[model samples]
Target: MSSILAHNLHLEFDFSYTSFPLVSLSIAFGVWLVWKTWKLITISRASLPLPPGPVPLPIIGNLHQMSVTDQSSTFLQWQEIFGDLVYVNIFGTPTLILNSYEDAKELLGVRSQIYSDRPRLSVAGELVGWNRSLVLGKFGERHRTMRRLLARSIGGKHAQSFRLHEEFAICTFLLNLLEKPRDLKLLLSQLTGSVVLDVAYGHQVKSGHDQLIFWFRRIVQDFYDATAVGSIIVDMIPALTYLHSYIPFTSFKKTVATWRAHLTETIEHPFSRVKEQLRNGIARTSYVAQHLSEGPLDFETEDALKYSSFNLYAGGMETLAVALSTFFFVVTKYPAIQQRAQQEIDNVTEGKRLPTSNDRERLPFVEAVMLEVLRWSPITPTSLPHRLEVEDIYKGYRIPQGAVVYSHPWAMSRDKRSYTSPHEFRPDRFLETPKEPDPRLFAFGFGRRICPGKHIADDTLFLAIALTLATCNVTKRVNEAGDLIEPIPQYTMGVVAHMAEFDFEITSRSDDAIQMLTAAHTQLGE
Candidate 1:
């Protein structure tokens, strides 16, 4: 009883005489609790309210309203209802959609350091092992270094060095198209994939059945399966990633294990081939060969080589094919666009010789058409998400740290403030004075995360569009009843949008065009 009395007296003395007291447990604990509460209150006052968005449901947030297939279109509708910065929460995960160029530019561009990081992709990265590649990997020294290496190889003018290979592929594509004009998708895939593979591993793809093409298709399908929005439970709730294996008697773990194995095979096979060719002193000049040739390689350097090579090929090939396919859709749907482009090409080439890389500057209208295609329908309508690194406030709206942010190129393309008649398909918009923002600026990406392979992809696309328009006429196919089968853009929108179901007729412009292709085939020794 005397000890208890003494303890109470000490607590009373501490509480009365000192703001900080180590002598009394109860008083010290109370002081610390008060300090923590004050800190939290201070932080709360500093941050403004979140950006406006549709009212979210409790606990589940906006998950019920999310669309798996048409996320961009849905976000676009929300942009109309809400403001440019639309905030959402999915199962406690915060998401912000920047529906205008200015918002995207201000946040994702001007403040790149705060917004450059990619969201953690639980299924695709952790389970399927794509985190080894830069696309799904975290941003850091490794990502920047790998991007530097890619920039050295193919970023800008270095892309011009691959013209011989590109021209060879284009010639083969044209020759095959002449024989089988209906094989649009097959021929275009071969063209884009072949160029990317050549640059990646020095593996030339001359046919549709090339082993690399099969590997490409496998990896692409696997990637889509792993990353399809609302498909993987762990991706939706990343905390569940740790518990995935313990989720009882399901083949989920085995499925992911198989996907992991396939990804390993796809990434390693070409790397092994390049090493073998180097050992025999017969290696071709390619990304892998060039990097391996420089004396010894540390583990980090070699790992960068392997994954960055895949990043280059995977990042570039699929989208180029889609963009090329969109070109066909655009020209077929609007013949006048094709005529203007063809006439421009004819004036440059004098209607005889094929347009080369040297003719790009002279073919302004062709470049405009290419720009318009990118703006008209961005393949990846909404960019891959960017994550905020720290809490920030913009325009009186607080953007929480770890919020997944997306810049909407689709909505930006249709902004009335930026483009006159935003819904119209006008290539001349690119040629006009005080030209609208170059879609290339936002199309490939923005800030530091922009595609390093943009130059090479642009070169290939310009050549293909110029050559195809110069040599052939794209028109709607006639049915068996001789009725014109008018084609509309039947887009099956997803992660990567495609006009996969459209049919159009491609035909040789004249006898001269056929002979030109024939001579090129002879030069190709095919």
Candidate 2:
């Protein structure tokens, strides 16, 4: 009986094993069906037309069509072929380029609630610890809080208090030009850095080589270099961040560690000094002082305030430096425009004194020239990237969530529909059509993410241009053969576009101009 039972059990096991193949086949068949369905769904979604763009290769996806150095021009060329909205992928990341003013306004401005978020910059923002910075921070409660604090501290009426700092900085620039004209670029950098320092922390920069200014300048340059599109591979392909430590000399982890250390010093050192001054009862009214007066804040809020206030120097200084450089480049390259601008300044001041922001209303031509400068060479050509928070469609084109949107101010400024002779640097164009939209609309940026320091920047540029033209004759450098060496207004390839180094001669317009600068310097006791 026991032998029979064992035989029966063996037979049952063999029978079950014989049927296993059928069950296996059924399971595999179900998996295949599910995979087929998923693939079809994916294909259907992908068939939705992305805005017209160059045919992309599998993984790179139009990366070959891009130039890391001149991305703005490349985007403009793509726009010519693809239309106002051009979609491309940077290493699997979807990017939307807005080449027209209307498109930019509709998407980045009008739809800001969903489009105001900043893209994650793995290398520049996260690795380098710049995520704390208001400019690079994500869109959230923290960003909103920082923006609100910044608006109260530096936007609109609050910005007016910085006009005196701008005036003083420009006055010093005028005097510096008289003594060391060859250092024009350095002087401009100092002027911008000094004004922002005074306004943000009530810290006066003693000279062009002030220790604080030096660190801030280095930090700004590095930040731009790190954040510029395509500068770091890890930024485009975030997964590569994991491999950063494994790479040899190409390790972004090591590079970012170094940058992070310096950035901490850059953001915290000055802020600590300001706090110390406040503790010692030697504080001056400034962004930091005002915020500190609000009482102690949580670590997160305090960090936000520090970074937000630092933005005055970080964002304002580099941009204004570049703008002032472009102004010099433009005026010197086109002497007739320079002459016209100088004539406007002369008329406004009547050669009696240095032009001030109080005379800004009367100096319409100078204002137009400033507008033209902003249009002709936008500092941040592709204003900072804005990311989408939700899926959206416009004009029958799909803009998926997480798409990085860039407003092409450089392209929009050159749009033929907006300005006649758009390529020409003509201030007269702005004067002719007072109703025409100013480039400042796009130059400073769009929506809630627009520059809060716009007022201070505008006032600083206006006064600097007015004072420089009123007191100095900016012209091309004369060669040994006595020929005028005209400057080619080539710009540096970065977010903050500055004119490449060029030779120029700046001289007092007349003895009266010299006297005016001298008197102003004496009044400031410089």
Candidate 3:
């Protein structure tokens, strides 16, 4: 009875002392919370103050408005509505689309320092473990070092050195194409895969169904499957990462392990063999061997084994291969463009020899055709996502820290503000332009994170496009019912967008084509 009475008395005393103080503190905290929430809401609502777009919902934001999986359609839709500059969001992550050359040059080109950082993809980094991915890595010292190493080894003047092997591979591929015209896909894949493998690892990949070729295809398919949007939902909701694997919702642990296992395996074997060969005094002047000889400095053994090899396989195969695939589509659809390109090639080379990298400057029309091809079918439509590390202003808008910054190459390429007939494939736009904008470099990317293997990709593309035009006419065949049939423009979506696989028939333009190809392959050892 005494204890109960004391407790009641203590409670009465405590209430008398704390009631007013508690109410005051509550009022102060409530006001602070309201102010902070309003500030966040205002900042979140703020954009670069460009064109209008669908307002985003708080938290999830505009992810619902845009296509997260296949952003091309979203980009296209925004272009129609938002004009040159459009803004969207993904879970409160700001995605600014530069829809014109003016916008691309202004934001991605002019203000490059502010625009160069990559968005932090928690899922992509931790789940699939692309933390070391050269293309997807953040803009910083590591990106610079990797890019510098790659540029010295592959891009710029050093890039020209790989053309010998590249041209040789092209000739061999042409011979195989002539022999098996039905398997155009296989021919193109082998042609590109061989060059990338040879240059990156010094492995001589063959024309059809080789081990290296098989593994290359397997790895690319796996990587694509793993990185496809929503492949890892834990990437978006990071708190879920800490959940117990025994729980039904936990999937990241399994997904991450699978991706790491495959990625590590592909990277390690080639590096080990390359290292072994270098130690044996039989040094091949390949990218991996070059790094290996320097002995674990800029590129650690694990990095050499994993990241570098992955970059070559991923960047080299997907971007170049998709571009070529789309080129095939464009050539078949627009024969006039093909004929014009071929005519220029014939006028310059006089039909005497295959087009070489040296002949690039002379064949302006052909170069224009390549440019149009890249523009029409942007391999990486949305050039990798960027992040703002520091809080700054873009065109008088307070762009808060950790906002996602995107460089929309697809949007920019198709913008009516830049190209007159942005919808159509007209190579003459590049040739007849009052000012010939540099299209080749932009197709790669901007600033420090620009593609390292861009030169090799370009040279290979030049050789392939020229030779394919030189050797055969790519045309859509009439169906069994005598109707003109066109291959559907279906795309596989990711950070790198690729055209769906389709077949096309090829026939030699002249008997001279076969002879010229034969002579070239005979002289050029594959």
Q: What would the TM-scores of all predictions be? A: 0.89, 0.88, 0.84
RMSD of each: 7.5, 10.3, 11.2
Q: Which candidate number would show the highest TM-score if scored against the true structure?
A: 1
Give one clash count per candidate, in the order shown. Answer: 0, 0, 2
Question: What's the lDDT for residue 244 in model 3?
Answer: 76
Better of 2 and 3 by lDDT: 2
The Cα error of candidate 2 at residue 484, in Å, is: 1.7
lDDT of all the models against the reference?
0.84, 0.84, 0.74
Per-residue lDDT of 75 in model 2: 89
Q: In candidate 3, what are the lDDT values of residues 211-241, reduced to their tens digit?
A: 7677767767666665566653556777776
User: Tens digit of lDDT per residue, candidate 2, span 36-113?
Assistant: 999996676666777887888899887888887778889888988988999998778788999999999999899999
Candidate 1, residues 1-526: lDDT per residue as tens digits? Answer: 9999999999998787885454587777889999999999668746568889988999989988988788887898899899799999987889999988888888888999989898878878888888878887788887887898888888788898887677778878887876787888888889988888888888888677998878877888888888875435667766665564667633466777888888898899999999999999988778788888887888997898899998777788778988999898889889999998899888888977888889989988899999998888887888888889988888988888899999988898888888888777899998999888788877888776788888888899888888889888889888899998887776778767887657778889999987886786567443
Clashing pairs in 3: 117-387, 123-235
